[model samples]
Target: MARMPLAERRRQLTEAAIRAMTRDGVSRTTTRSIAAEAGVSLSVFHYCFDSKQALLESVLTMITDHYIAVVKEAIRPRATLRETVRAGFQAYWDHVAARPAEHMLTYDLTQYALREPGFEHLARRQYELYCETYAQLLEQLGRQTGFELLVPVPVLARYLAAMTDGVTLNFLVLGDADAAAGILDMVTDHVAGLIRER
Candidate 1:
């Protein structure tokens, strides 16, 4: 039998790890199990990742990075602050809705991150990157629309980021799409009103 290509194998392992974490939760995911699911050997899993924590961190980073890029791309040039906020939320809703399993993986890792040193740093980095990305977009929109932010850009960015994370958890836990949508609309309107008032 031919050996699998290295890049292909790595991708398979990452995806399999995400699925495994989603099904069994990060605490239950092991290198052996991930390798078995990927149809690879334990050595192959080790070759790709130093440990299960690393594998889970990679999965979380993959999900967060992909969504960050999507949200960044969705913000139109010359966008009003309100329009940019709407676009960011829309991107988030679509991404979360489409990849519910990835979101579950994120939640599991988040729970583990509270105690796991390996994942704690990765989680913090991911959160900081996301905040900075959103803050940059917000600042740009503020400049374009001549609407000063009521809160500091960093504070506003963190607030919006936390709100989205909370909404994702609420939607996943309660399966309440209507409530989630309504709350997001309300939050966006309030933020818009604040921006206009400033």
Candidate 2:
């Protein structure tokens, strides 16, 4: 294959960094390791990312984008509200299970963001954006289908999103997908009940 251009190389390096962090946690994904993984020199890594934090922030964004896509793809208009919600949860669970180590990377980046003023703000805004977007989608679906949403769509969406995050964290902490899946089932049932109520 032809050599990748600088722009492509930068993107490749960033993606490789994300993969490394997901596999080994952020602390273990040093600049050297990322450079090695990307088949580039340490100097190239620095040239692309001024600091490790910058690289990590970029990788975090990539991971977040991947996760958001997973959630979006799971929302099928043909499905009932409850099934849509359950499918969303299952998609999230599968995302975690597909690359369990990525959960650690996500948690680590979350913790890392907590310490930085800029990243903290971005994290908060991103989460709020997700809540708003999903809430609106759920509300529209409810209105379109005449489904009795258990809670207002806005609140329900936020709650489900939070539950999804909580489940991911639990799996990361316990290293037990089974336990996480069981808890997810309970959360799913509660969400379904909310929408199913008359």
Best by TM-score: 1
> Model 2: how far is 93 from its true place, Å?
1.0
Model 2, runs deviating above 4 Å: 1-7, 115-154, 193-198
- Model 1 misplaced stretches (Cα beyond 4 Å): 1-9, 77-81, 117-119, 139-150, 194-198
Q: Give one digit per residue, the lDDT tens place, for model 1 in 1-198.
A: 258887777778988888887888878888889988898889988887777666766776677778878877776643466667687688879898998878877777777887776567767866786687778778766665667877788888898888888999999999898998898888978788768634
Residue lDDT tens for model 2, 41-79: 898888888876677667766776787678667766555
Full-model lDDT for every candidate: 0.78, 0.73
Candidate 1: worst-modelled 10 consecutive residues by lDDT: 75-84
TM-score of 2: 0.73
RMSD of 2: 3.7
